[model samples]
Each structure stands twice: as structure tokens, then as C-alpha cells.
Target: MGSEFAEKVILITGGGHGIGAAAARCFAEAGARVALADVDRQAGDRLSEELIAHHRQALFVEADVSEGRDCKLAVERVLDTFGCIDILFNNAGITRRANVVETTEKEWDAVIDTNLKSVFLMCKYVVPVMASNGGGVIINTASGWGLVGGKEAVSYCASKGGVVLLTKAMALDHGKDNIRVNCICPGDTRTRMLVEEARQLDLSTDDLIEEGIYRPLGRVGEPGEVAASVMYLASSLASFVTGTALVVDGGGLAGSA
Candidate 1:
């Protein structure tokens, strides 16, 4: 599957680090021109330079995807640089580990806007462009919690659950336009975000890993593992796959099923 993405243009939000950054490298290695839309200028610029060093086309757009203006401008910048967006990876998201009572209105809004609304905002702008251009692939980064409820994470669960359905709804609404929409439900991966989640739970990274050892794989996942799944969905291999939530959670939800 190496070079299957030759000449494709993929726009990734939250592209500065973790799964987004990993996917950027994967796509670049596969010969895709990648545009990173992220709020972290330093990380984005650094990653872009790395890709360019490897002779890959890469652009970093500083953006807060929760805002419509930023999303629109980011897409425009990608089009201006690459001329087209063959794929859109909505990976920008945040989590607040709190129940409804513990979650303040501001916290809930922040989680919802960043996790759920950003998908809507980016797609709102990119979908029409894809439709007019004859079709494109869109991959959203939802969580395993999106497929099932989790304790002490009401807003996050709600936001990701929304993404799970939103992806399906978009696929149904835009299939005629040839736009494919899907989401990935990842479990506790070893990202900075995962480490941060450990901190939020007042535990060390090791503790977090230990807590997730019950997965059928007996371990958490890696960013590249999840990125591989995204690549599959964006490739011709999954041309017949749409409105699906492909779980890449190391069998974390297998037993629950």
C-alpha cells in the first residue's frame, strides 16, 4: 500500500502531534501532499520541515478548527497551495474527564466545539469543495468512548458519540455526491493526549497503561497503527466502505460486544 496515495492531497487538523502527526508522516511516505491545519505553530512548522526534508509536499496552516472562519481559511490555503483536497482528516479534538455534574458549561462547550463542532465546521466548508470536484474521502477521529459510554467523561463521550453518528449521516447525505465519510474509534493510545488524560485522572503514564492492559491485545495502541487504518479508509481499498466506524482499539471493545 506504500505509494497508493501518490499525488493525493490530504488536509489534517490537529496535525501538529500524536495521531495527526503520525498520519502526516505516513501519507507523506506514501507520496501524498499533506496540509496540516493546527493551532500549534511550532510543532506544525517543525513537522512540515521534516516532510520537506524527505522531499514531500507539506504545508502547515495555523488554525483553530472549532471556528468556521479558521476552517474556511485553512481549506482555502490548502487549495491555493495544492489546488485540490482529495482527502480531509478531521483529527482535531480535546477531552475533559468529568461527569455532567463535574463538567462546567464552559468545559462542556469547549469539548463539544473542539471535538464535535470542528468536524461539522470543517466538513461544512470542505464537503462542497469535494462534491464540486467530483468526490473525496473524509476520515474523522472519534474515540472508542464514542462507540460506548465511559465513566467520568460525560462531555467527551457525548461529543465523540456525536461524531460517530455524524459520520454516518454525512455519508448518507453525500453518497450521491460521491463523498465518503467514516470515523475511527481508537482506544487508549500512547499519545501526548493519552498522557494528559492520565494526568487528569491523577495517575502516571504507567498507571494509565496498566489500566488499559485488560484489552484483548493486552496493551494500548500506537499512533501509526491508527494512521494505517485511516490510510486504508482513504485508499481505493475502502472505496466500497462508507458510513462506517472502523474500530482500531486493540480489541478494547471486543469483550464488551
Candidate 2:
């Protein structure tokens, strides 16, 4: 175990699976006490056990991040258990694969609340704790589609876009308090969410996976890769970095022309 983050406490939303789970493991491996908050109690508890089995400090908090009360409660539990939050990974999000017209009001609200508002809610409570503690790091998970646009993913794109901008705004507001806020815009990553996105679009999983490899990197990214990026942004190595959207998208957004 590395001690880079030995005394740090990292709270991750959506910590049950995919990139969120990968990030929890990564931070724990680096010696950080990790708080896993997710709507799925089973997955969250399972991951916490796995980490504890490895002798890592870990806690699982069931939370629906979209709700302010849940976000507040999750932060409170982490603070009570870990002392103070040194880092926060706002990785909770959902996707609604539909064009604007085909998208219903509820679907749009759900995506926005989960993907964007959760970041705000988490920050709303965590920022003060971080500020009083002297300083901290926050890394949000945006998407490549957030920077650009995607067909049949209006709600997803919009929500992620909001996240990207919200990250920047928070960074600007919190830099004075020594809180660094940054977001990663990943390309097609191999996650349950990605698989479900294909299903929503009525596409074969094999076909979708195959198409993902057409990017410059010639392969879809794994959750671990994205987790690594989050780790970087959360570490002191990025002390001077803030208000930036770090793209980890295998160059998919690179113009073909």
C-alpha cells in the first residue's frame, strides 16, 4: 500500500460500480479511507467488505445523491467515521438515451438531477467542511458527449454538459479556499451504464463495443483507466490545476476531417 493518501478521506458518490467502484479501490489502495455512497445497498456493502478484507479503511453509505437530504446524510456519515473529507469524487450519474422530442420531462429531470445536481448537492455540504479543514479536492465524472454532442442522447449530453460547466464554476469559486474542482470527460467506457445505453438505443452490445474501438486508441476505455484520472486530479500532483475539464476520451472527440 502506497501512503500518498494515507491520512486522506475520499467520499465517492455512485461508489457501487463502474468507474465509481474503480475509483474507490484506487484511493483505498493508496491508503485513503474511502466512503462509498450509492443507491444500491448490496453493491456498496459488497465493495466495502472487499476493501475491509484487504485491510483497507472503508465505509458504505446508502444514498440517493439526487436528493439533498441523502447527500447531506452521506457526508455527515463520512465525517463522523473518517474525521474530515480530504477528497470528493462526484461520480454519480444516469443516462437517458433519447432525442429531445422523444425524451419525457421526468427522464430529463432524472438525468439532470443525478448527473449534475448531485454534484452541486454534494459540494454544497462538502465544501464547507473542506474549507474549514484548510483544503481539499473534488473530481467530477463528466462525459465526452458532454463536451461534444451525441445522437439520441439529449438528456445525457445536457446533464453531463451541466456537470462540465458546474465543475468550472465551482473551481473558480472555491480556489480561494484551497478547494480544487475538476471534471473528467471520458469517452466510451466499458461500464454497465454504457451497456444499458446501447440497450436503450436498440443496438447490439457486440456492435457497440466494436464501434468503440474505432477511436484513435483503438479500444474502449476501462473503468480503471478513468479511475486513474480521478486519482490524479484528487492528488497533490494537481495542486495548481483547477477549473479544467480533463478529457480522457481516447481521442474520440478528435475531428475526423
Candidate 3:
């Protein structure tokens, strides 16, 4: 496992923080050259520097992933730096916690475009490169809510649900090309995104995370935990695995109602 990705290159969206950042560190530790793309330039640059300081190969690209042009440029920049991308993690995402009635058009578009469309945009550019290069891995970040509905997040639920099917469709289409596509359905994890979700609901991060305490594991997840799942999906261990949503929520959805 340590040497499995020694010379491979990984391009990660949302790689500035949270699960993306955590996964970047894990891959770097495994000897992969990592390219992080994020709209948050400061956070992205900081993480890249941190990884370099630790003797890891890392690059940061400022990108608004929801747009096609930016996604193309991001892929181009990564290829320019790393030569090839063996894995593409479409992990950039956002959430708007609101029911249909409360979710504005802007909010709905933001959630859908970020959570779902970004996956398609990135794949549109990277898939051809992977195909020409022989093969590659794609790990998308869908949520447990994508499998089950959330109380006040209609748009988020809808977008993630789209991701689930989109992942499958891509897997079917790309399997012949030897390009594996899968998505992770993680339960509540401790990350900046969780903090933003808490803010949307007017609850403290601890209070929000407490909602996940009833899961069998009885705790919110750490970003590294979810990142571990990402590693598995990207690794050869899942060579025969594609189109599946590997849930990493510590049983968060085992008892979903």
C-alpha cells in the first residue's frame, strides 16, 4: 500500500481543506504527486506549502470548479506540472440547508452546480486524458443524504442523489476504457463544511455533530476517516470496484428512517 501510488499523480478538487485536504495528505504520504484545485486560493496555497514543508510533492490551482472553463484550465495546469493524472477526485461541493420553499433559485443552482455538475465538468475534460493514457480512477464525494433525504436540505439531497446516478452512468460508460468511477457517501464528518452547515441551521458545530451521535459508532467522523475511504476507492484494492457508493459514516445511515 505504501508504494502503490509512488509515481502516480492525483488531481483533487476542493483540496484546500476538509476531506479533500485530508485525502491530499494521505496520497502525498503514499508518494503521489498531488494537485489541489480550489476557489479558496489562500487555503489552497497554504495547504500546498504545508505539504511541501513535509517533503511532499504538491501543487495548488485556483479554480471555480462549477464552471467548465475553469475545470479545463485546472486539468491543463495539473498535466503541465505532473505530466499525467492517474486519479481525479471530484470532491468540490457546497450545501444550502433549506426546504424547497425556502431554497432560493440562487441557492438551488449553487448546490446543484457545485455538488453535481462539477463532477460532470471535471470528468468531461479528464476522462479523455485518462482514456488516452490507458486508465485512471475517479472518486466523487456524495453524502449519506444522497442516499436518504435530509430534513431541511432539499437541494442538497437532490444534487447528491444526482451524483449517485451520475457516478453509475459514468462507471458503465468508462469501464470499457478501464477508467473506474465511484462516489463516497460519507456521514457527518468534522470539517469546515460541517461548520458551514451548522451556521446555516443556527446551531453550534458541536450541537450539529451531536446529531450523529446516535449512529452505531456514536460520533461524528474525522476528515481523515473519510479520506481513508477515498484512498481505498483510489487504490488498486478497489480495482474491480466501480459505480458503488462506499459509505463511511460509522453507520449513520444504517438506521435511517
Error of 1 at 125 (Å): 0.6
Per-residue lDDT tens digits for candidate 3, residues 1-257, read: 45898979999999998999999999999999999999999999999999999999999999999999999999999999999999999999898988889999999999999999999999999999999999999999999998999899999999999999999999999999999999999999998888899999999867878877788998999999999999999988999999999899998778754
Lowest lDDT sum, 10 consecutive residues, model 2, at 204-213
Query: lDDT, candidate 2, residue 74?
Result: 94
Query: Model 3, which residues run further than 4 Å from truth?
Result: none
Off by over 4 Å in 1: none
Candidate 3 global lDDT: 0.93
Residues 17-132, candidate 1: write the lDDT tens digits.
Answer: 99999999999999999999999999999999999999999999999998989999999999999999999999998888888888999999999999999999999999999999
| TM-scores of the models, in the order given | 0.97, 0.98, 0.98
Kindly list the per-residue Cα lDDT of model 2 for residues 1-257, writing each as its tens digit: 45779969999999999999999998998888999999999999999999999999999999999999999999999989988999999998889899989999999999999999999999999999999999999999999988998999998998899999999999989999999999999998888987888889888876667787689999889999999999889877898999999999888888793
On the 0 to 100 scale, the lDDT of residue 153 in model 2 is 92
TM-score attained by model 1: 0.97
Please give the ranking of all candidate structures by lDDT, highest first, separated by commas.
Answer: 1, 3, 2
Give the lowest summed-lDDT range of ten residues in model 3. 204-213
